[model samples]
Target: MADKLKFALALALVAAGVVGFYLLGEQPLVLRVLAVFAGVGAGVGVAALSAPGRRFIDFAREAVVETKKVVWPSRKETVQTTGIVFAFVVVLAIFLWLTDKSLEWVLYDLILGWK
Candidate 1:
């Protein structure tokens, strides 16, 4: 129940920031942007006090750690893989075009006796 209220308050804070941005139309652009950021920061702070927020924080930490363990493909390997994909696509396109032309020849010239 308390967590839900906290979430609701956070949402209200963010909404207030957006409203302030529009209302401060005559104000400086930086101040208007800051208002939204301040609202979002405050809202996040409030929400982080809740159970779900803590879990989300934990999950984000875990995701960052897991990402560090990833082995990214080297530039050379990436280029080679891209080249292979392009070659395959080109070959497939030629094959399909030949098949279409062959089918048209059979249907129009042989079957219908029309040049």
Candidate 2:
């Protein structure tokens, strides 16, 4: 409860600082930096206050650990995949161009009676 209150108070101070800056027609850089830092601090305070937030942090930590266990693709594999992607793109472009020209031929020569 105390942490929640502190979080809210910190957020309010950040908000007030921003509004005051705009109202006063562009405040100092130091003040803006302080406001941003305070806002981030408030967010961290809120996250620290709750069990669910802590659980998320723990899950993220475990995910990073597990990620380290997996083998990443080699540069040779990456280059091969990129080559396959370009081939597919070229094939699809040819297919689409054929379809478009066929549709144009049918619509102009057959339907509307034009050359």
Query: lDDT of all predictions, in order shown?
Result: 0.97, 0.77
What ranges in model 2 sit over 4 Å off? 1-25
lDDT of 1 by residue, 1-115 (tens): 9999999999999999999999999999999999999999999999999999999999999999999999999999999999999999999999999999999999999999999
Q: Indicate which candidate wins on lDDT.
A: 1
Q: Residue-wise lDDT of candidate 2 within 20-97, one digit each (tens)?
A: 556645768777667666666666666656665677789999999999999999999999999999999999999999
Query: Quick one: RMSD of model 1?
Result: 2.2
Rate residue 65 of model 1 by lDDT.
98
Cα deviation in Å at residue 69, candidate 2?
Answer: 2.1
The TM-score obtained by model 2 is 0.72
Error of 2 at 113 (Å): 1.9
After TM-score superposition, the amount by which residue 23's alpha carbon in candidate 2 deviates from its true location, in angstroms, is 6.8
